[model samples]
Target: MKSPIFSRSSSPLNSHSSISPPLTPRRTFPETIMEENIDYATTIITKWDLDGPTYRKMSSLFGDDRKEAKRFIEGVTGLRNAMHYYLKINSSSEKLIRAQRLMQVAMKRLEKEFYYILSSNRNVLDAESVSRGSTRSSLSDSLEDEVQGDEIIEDGNSISEADKASLMAMADLKSIADCMIGSGYGKECVRIYDLIRKSIIDESLYNLGVEKINPSQIQKMDWNVLEAKIKSWLQAVKIAVKNLFYGERILCDSVFSSSEKIAESCFAEISRDAAINLFGFPENFAKSKKILSPEKMFRALDLYEAISDLWPDIEMIFSYDSLSAVKCQGVASLVKLGESIRVMLTQFELAIQKDSSKSPSTGGVHPLTRYVMNYLVFLGDYSGVMSDTVADWPLNAQTPLPESYFSSPISGGSAIEDPSSAVTVRLAWLILVLLCKLDGKASLYNDVALSYLFLANNLNYVVSKVQNSNLGLLMGSEWISKHESKVKQYTGNYERMGWIKVIMSLPKNPTAEFSLQEVKEIFSLFNSGFEGTYKKQSGWVIPDRKLREEIKLSLAKKIVPSYRVFYEKHRGKIGREFGVESIVRYAPEDLNNYLSDLFFGTEVSTSTKTWSSYETSSESSLSSHRR
Candidate 1:
């Protein structure tokens, strides 16, 4: 009932280029030398031919044992050298040309044969896509039909046998990929594994009888078949990783090394394959049209979380616990994983920024910023582990510790001061790093107000989380206070910058020169400021209710009294000269109401009103400010 997996190899055409001597001075190599070269090239071409059964014979002898697989893989070095020698050598002779074509054939054959052998050995549990009794040729034909816009066979039983053969071929390819990993070809093994998965997924979807799986077309898929393919693909990858670790001592050694490059490679491949499956095909793939779904994103996060939760198991698998091998208990691995996740979050943030920028109507916080900050919140749970691991870290000489951060009793006598402070300070610094990154994402907003508001909200959220969690201990109270100040700074900047023009319009200290002409100018200034600010800010939104209140109150404190005093002193006097009511365009009460409406984003009418509500609000604001 398993779905069939398929694979194909594109054979490169033979190309020729050779340098010739201008003068015919025939200095011929010895016959023995020429014969030896030809024999070596021929031997290489023969062994390299997967279709010739040479590799199959070797695999049968080597069996599935890791040690033997390594040995058999090593034996291919000579054949590889010969093939390279044939390809790189300068020759236009018929013999060389013929040999090159043979080499190409041998390569294609090996590719096909290896895949089939591996598939057969694995008993591919996902062969449901392939019809029973189909040949490779027929599978290729079916692929062509699908590509040519032919209808898909809806019946599960009608799945082509050629499809099954292709799947088997893919299995054989994975087996070879396993051998590659065992042979210390870590990067190459990863590449091969990625290619194999992409091929299977691409083929299955292509044969699924749909151009693209739109929302409406999603129901057309045979869920059982798709699920089987997904399960088999994931299981195969797991098995490959297990084989690589358990079978080859060299692989185990490399994977568990201090550098952990091999482990990183494996994880990268796993992440990529998982992402492709869950998130849909990358843009390069044909018929790739899946929207970024929430389910896929959450699943991706879950995969990362699962890995994070099982860090100890991963360490054990790679023998990271060997006392002499590594100095720390899984700290290095965890740090590396954290770094990788940060990179993913950065990419997500950029993507969100790009999409949001394209649509100007969208308002409020971006999901990318939320997702990354939420992830950091979860990551904060491990601050204790991180702090403990790096507790004895030497103080950074370049960046001296602040005096305020050393109030702990541990700072009493020794010049060295609190050791725990070093870890905690850096933990705080790391949290700041995420905030700074989120700030960068917020800057991508087209609306300046939205950008600042986004930053304020996120920065505020991060500070709260860190102070509330164990991360606070590492970062210390001083660190939390510093970031809290920064959030306030942002809010302050938003108020001051956005309303600078409006504030500037208020009259300064009245002097002897403040006559009827100056009074008219002051009224003019007030009218212009009210008109400009109301028009500019009316449509802008402040999603957080508390932030809105704080912003509005701050504005009222700055504008209410200045306007109330200016209007009371000058309103009647200026109105008489400029025709009474015309000169006093807006009353003191009108100024208070306008200030209250500042961040509420409500519309304002420019018509004149009486001063009944002015004294109470202005007195209250002035009293609060004095306190």
Candidate 2:
């Protein structure tokens, strides 16, 4: 057979002359050996040439001719080998020119097929579906095997239809990508892939309701609107990090598994900008001045927590050096949120200390007590997040809490005992500030007994609040017990100061023999003192039902029994001398009836109306803070 390597005369190197040049002796292969090699290369390329009429009529190489797709890749490989062989032996050979032309035609076909597969499989290749497909390790192994000319085999019974479709499409993409990239057409392939995939990610974020919010826009928004956005962002961020960006990364890594440089470049170009914007929203929102109020502290903590919880995923997905800005943005949001919460906490403590409102006239719960306790209770619910935010934040050093302040075994040991208990100590400190303020407010009362009653009422409220909610868990049982004891002590003082005169009026022994004049003096003094005590305490109040009953029971044990014994013993003697109705004004049953009416808070004297106005004003103030 004529040697095909030297048989062609249509070569550009031969077209300029009709005669061949004089032969120079050189090492050469036998005609049969060179002819067989050239013939084999031409056969492979001719068999799968995509420029043939049949392939031209077809829509896509991968779609219309699935079997030929494998042959087509093999043909490109064969063409590449033939061109290299010809370049080494005869650089201007007609066979090399034909092989170069075929390579270009093959590249054009693969690029079109790559775009077709991507555009047609958008649904199957969505973020959720792709993430649900093969894991990165397995996918990379399969891609490496495919590059080495091994068919990737997956169990059809294992994955769902969507997952199977995604894997199959991904395999097809990587196959074409490997061939095209090997042939130096990577830029064309990457451009198409980047444009289509970037839009998908951007659309996914939009569907998730993540928007690019600026600080100025957040500042101008109504709190209600901003709160809604924060809520939306919270939900969107989880899906973005775990599914959207995660799946894109897996897909990119698998498709470009053959080239680490190209894979990192493509993944960063497609995902970095969107990820930065998604995380930057929280930072911008935290930077807004309007959300700095104490009332908005919870929302800021929620933002901090979402980023904190997703930190591992963020670190893993955006680990590339080019994606560092996304990680930086996420960290900045957390810092801004933590700073906002700390500022609000300071504002909250100041609001308690600076409260100038008069104490309630009835000596019931103060408005500040209700507001601060309720605020702390809500805050305690977020202890997990708050602990992280305030871990490094120590309490103010200038004010200097006493060692005994947190000394109770239940008050979290000592204030500085557990360095990890920053939030616990911070909350405890706020309550302490409130208690000190209540002590100052107690001084507003002129009547010593009412002042004690006020302290008892406010302290009892604080104890009840601590016992009822998450505060109980954070402050521990011992803390609640210690505060309860303080409440009891205040109530004990109240009982002594409020009714000492009435109790002192009775004789040391009610049955002691005495003259009618002495007995008359006793009855007169008892009548005058009991009436005065009742009139003075008529408007005082204890709002807590349980505490009110407890105080009443204590008083009954101390006052009612003794008074009853004295009254029964003296009544007949006093009446025999002076008329019973005139001297013995109160029957024992009458004391019980009056004590039941004590804490109703129905009427206050004009002298104490300033204290009475506190209820309305403080309630109004608390309502405004809530809004």
Provide the clash count, candidate 1.
Answer: 27
* lDDT string, candidate 2, 432-486, tens digits: 9888998998888898888888888888888787788887777777777888888
Residue-wise lDDT of candidate 1 within 1-627, one digit each (tens)? 533332222212222343444796663564345445556646654654555666555544222333433333333433344334545565565655665565455444434444445335333324322222222223221122322222234233344545543343433344454434443344544554345534544454344421332334433445445334433433333332233222222222222233355544443443333223322311111121231322123222333343344444334444522231221322433344334333443444444333322111222333333344444444445443433334555434232545443222234534245555544554444444455556665676665655666567666766666667656655566667877788788778777766777788776653224677778877777678777877766666555677677877788888777877776676666554546666677776776676666544432212122111221243342222110
Query: Scored by Cα lDDT, where does model 1 land?
Result: 0.45
Give the lDDT of residue 92 in candidate 1. Answer: 63
Q: Candidates' lDDT values, in order?
A: 0.45, 0.77
Leading candidate by lDDT: 2
Model 1 TM-score (2 dp): 0.37
Candidate 2 TM-score, true structure as reference:
0.83
Model 1, residue 461: distance off in Å is 4.5
| Residue 465 lDDT (model 1) | 60
